[model samples]
Target: MSKKHKSEHHEEHADESWLIPYADLLTLLLALFIVLFAMSTTDSKKFEEMSKAFNIAFNSGSGVLDNTTIVTTGEQMSKERENNRQPSKEDLTKEQLQAAMKQEQEDLEKLKKQIDNYIKTAGLTTQLETKLNQSQLMITISDNALFPSGSAQIKPEARSLALTIATMLNKYPGYEIVVSGHTDNEPISTAEFESNWDLSSSRAIRFMDILLSSKKLDPKLFSAIGYGEYRPVDSNANALGRSKNRRVEVSIIRKFTDPDKSQNIPATPK
Candidate 1:
């Protein structure tokens, strides 16, 4: 009887051994649920990347999906549309060029009126000419009007010119001012300048200092450079051309946007 009872007890426990496989099935089902929950919560952009990687791992040539996941498409068909997207390298370079030109355009018109009025009032229009172009607003001051030959010093009368420009600049708050000095190709050897290069650069720096000296402006927004007859407005062949080239150029930093504000790079293009 004791042997038989022991045998029956052993048989009952033998059927219970299937619990191990049952527990394993439950574990696998729980893991599947967790994975599905994680997939549901992932970010769309990151999910797109992950999907692509998985597809590649599976050795599928076709991409995960066609334009199903993306950020934007760049197109500028109108002006009112806010271009608040990140621009591509080509788009960015082109935007910089366009902004530079457009910014110059508005500046030219305003500068024209202001300069014409000043010239008319102060009787210095012919001697001090304002020129407008695609990239710069140039106020040309004859040596007789602004400085002595080879000297960076601004004449007393030239103070009005600086003040007027500064006032105009104050009206437009977000522009960088670039003052560039150009010199005639003729060699300049003097105490003031080791060569035309020095003279040109010094003249640019000196004039820029006059602008930053204004308490209203920030020093960070101004730049000075010397072109030393390289970017002459006309041929070095004549006195008139050289005179035009020998003047100072004041450039207003144009606005529209930088690449950070206007460009959007999408991952699918790659």
Candidate 2:
């Protein structure tokens, strides 16, 4: 009877062995839930560490989860901020730039017309000429109109002419005016000027000074240059050619434009 009781006890314990694996499965499920809950609350860096621990415990050196996209909360926030950094296009639209350019063109044309009319009325067309190009509107004046032979000083009779020109220039504000002087190939040496370069430069500066004497014009918008005899419009072989070469040029430059540059300017910062 004692031997029979031992056999029945051993058999009862054999079925109870299944409970060990069941308890292990329940523990694994609980760990999985805890890992998932932690991942939802923490950053990706911490989550990766926890995942490694769980994988080592449950998977026995194998991976329990597959590799996937793992962006941190901080990383996600940074990405969102970057997306919002683009400039707004409302303040500097393309239409606004085009309108501004059009207005500038109209102002330039009006100023040219006024100058042209003045030249015609004064009967100075023979001595003065105007040329318009992509870069500037140039008013060319013969040297004889403003000075005597080898003299850098403006003629006393030309004072009225200078005043008239200054008055006309005063009508246009905020424009860059360049006064450039050119001379004939004939060399000149006198008590005042030693060479053509000196003569031309002095003439340019003298003319510019007169133009800036008007209170309505800004001195900062004017500059003087001298080309001497190097930049001549005609050959120096004859009197007429030499006459055309000795001239003063007043140039009014276009505002903020380049014909070769792209017209589609970016309205806002990139």
Candidate 3:
């Protein structure tokens, strides 16, 4: 009976030892499954945090999660670099503004050249002049070209010249044209007109009417002004100087004048 009791006690001890190893195996399997789940997830940042927690709990600083944090940091840095490469709105707007200004300058230069060529070809250099200034493109016509002495009426032959000028001007739309008339410092008292102001004003209106007669010309873009004897380009002391002073001007205003250099008038004379 003593031998049987000792055998039972030994059997109990062996069973307890087997149960301890089984519990250890189950714990190892659970840890392995947790590591696999963390690796399969797409969030590298979260995986890195979880790995750090596990390292702290296990009192070990080495794991695969360290590599995951490096990858996450690299991705964030790459995104920042891409954002820096993008252009801002102010930069794009500045480039576009420069391009537009350049295009406008070219167009104005071309138009000025065309007018100059016409003036040279027509043998009207003495009776006509064109100037491109910062404020406007001015085409000056001698009073003898369009009117007689002490008269506001435009000559019959001058109508054809006005028509030709209108045709050329119609090619460039959206520009404001000011037809201004100036007289010499000679007082006029006639049955038709009272003073130089009335004569100059009447001449300007008549010329503008002829220019606006074209079907392609817009009347809204044209205006008439009379400077009378006030704005004289030359002294009215002699006949030659008076002739130069008595003139009609057609001015095409600039669309985009530079604000910084607005007062600087770049004169291209012809």
What is candidate 3's lDDT per residue for 123-225, written digit by digit as tens?
8888888887677888999999999898888999889879988988888887889999999998999999898899889999999999999989889989999
Write model 2 residue lDDT over 38-132, tens digit each, in one string. 57753566567657656654865323333222234335646766786643324446776456556666666677778889889989889988876
Q: What TM-score, over all chains together, does every model reach?
A: 0.54, 0.61, 0.62
Candidate 2, position 165, lDDT: 77
True lDDT of residue 203, candidate 3: 92
Poorly placed runs, candidate 1 (over 4 Å): 1-108, 257-270
lDDT of 1 by residue, 140-238 (tens): 666556678878888887877877878777777656678888888988788768898888888888778777777788778888998886878777888
Identify the superior model by TM-score, candidate 1 or candidate 2: 2
lDDT agreement with native, every candidate: 0.65, 0.76, 0.78
Q: Of the pair 1 and 3, which is ahead by lDDT?
A: 3
